[model samples]
Target: MATGLILIFDKTHFSKYFVVPSTLGALLALAIPDLEGGAHDDIIYNGLNPNAVNNSKKYGINWGYDSHLFWEFLITHFLSLVLPFFLQIIQPKEEKITIKVLWKSIYLTFSVALFLFFFSWIIYAIVEKHGSPAQQISWNANWFYMGHKGISTLGELTKWPYNIISLTIIFFVLFWLVFVIKIYFEIYSFNLSYQNRKIRFFYIKRLKKTVFKENVIKSKH
Candidate 1:
């Protein structure tokens, strides 16, 4: 999601205008839940250590709490769709962003981020020991890992996959920051070129009108 947002805002064109408000919606989606005493939805991770998994009594936010899984799921993902829809309605046609661009941005960013995640997963598999012979390692896909992870949230502090995943996330964020910065400058330059063309076109148009007026007056004389 973070990477997706970065991609969306990578242009000075409609992307920034479109991306920012939508991002706000996303932020609100995340923040409102926590503010209203809700917990973030997360993945339920089967731990490498049985003791750690046992420590996590629940997989995610308390089921009985005000933060129900249903609402959390809706708010976190769907609310973002509203912002772009409203922007499309009120925003000018020329400045409008296309769904293709949005999808491309999201796909490109996700591909890069996913690479990091998978790469780290490989490292973790090699280095991190699985649970004891009697313990089973399992991951719940209900949340699809976009949310929070299993019981040992704090217990992740001592785990091996913990650091690798953390590093992977951090790497994506840093790489994404640099990528956005480059795109920002490119967007600025692109817009500047457009502005220059508009200015030149305006002068050429005035010149044509002036010449036409001069010819009409001469003909009248």
Candidate 2:
């Protein structure tokens, strides 16, 4: 098999049609509350969006666990792609025959996403504890708040070991997210043949032997 470089999209179109919109979408999705009530979901979606809730009911829209899962995947994948693009890092594109690339991508994505989630929690705590009453209320009114309310609620629960429980649940959720991403890559690879394999990979360039020889000769003088 030939070693090749993969180009995802046009770099020139980064500002207009690509990265900006995706960044916004991922942020918005991250900021949206989960549909059903659960401790982890409550932690993530500190304040539920009433409008979203009303719309779902009115339109008969089934925005549940699956919808949240998709957003999580989008967030992970977007971070994986956008962060590398901005840093001028080139990741090996996923080849159909090799899953090594997929594993690498997922590992990086999961690490970054985990760091971000923890960072968000820290910020939430700082704001809730130190901010003014209005600030605290407004913060909890948004989906990003995961401070006193959620944690305190868990704390109040019949003296249960919620901290340990929450951590355990978090571990499983993250594992599941990685599994879902892997499955997605597998499906995409399986479908490549019928789609004309739009993914393009180019060989990495290297200097010719003559040029290297000339450089070495010049350096020796």
In terms of lDDT, which candidate is strongest? Answer: 1
TM-score of each: 0.30, 0.30
Please write out the lDDT profile of model 1 over residues 1-221, one tens digit for every residue. Answer: 54246447853244433453345335434543332122222222322442344323443435434656756667556656454555444543533333344344545545654565555455445434664422212321112122222113335631343533553454346444633553444343322235644743222123444444432343343
Once superposed on the true structure, which residue ranges of model 1 sit more than 4 Å away at CA?
1-70, 92-95, 98-110, 116-120, 123-221
* Colliding residue pairs in candidate 2: none
Q: For candidate 2, what is the TM-score?
A: 0.30
| lDDT of residue 114 for candidate 1 | 54
Worst 10 residues of 2 by lDDT: 1-10
lDDT of 2 at 136: 53
lDDT of 2 at 148: 31
- Structure candidate 1, residue pairs in collision: 41-147, 41-148, 42-147, 42-148, 43-148
Write down the lDDT that model 1 would get.
Answer: 0.40
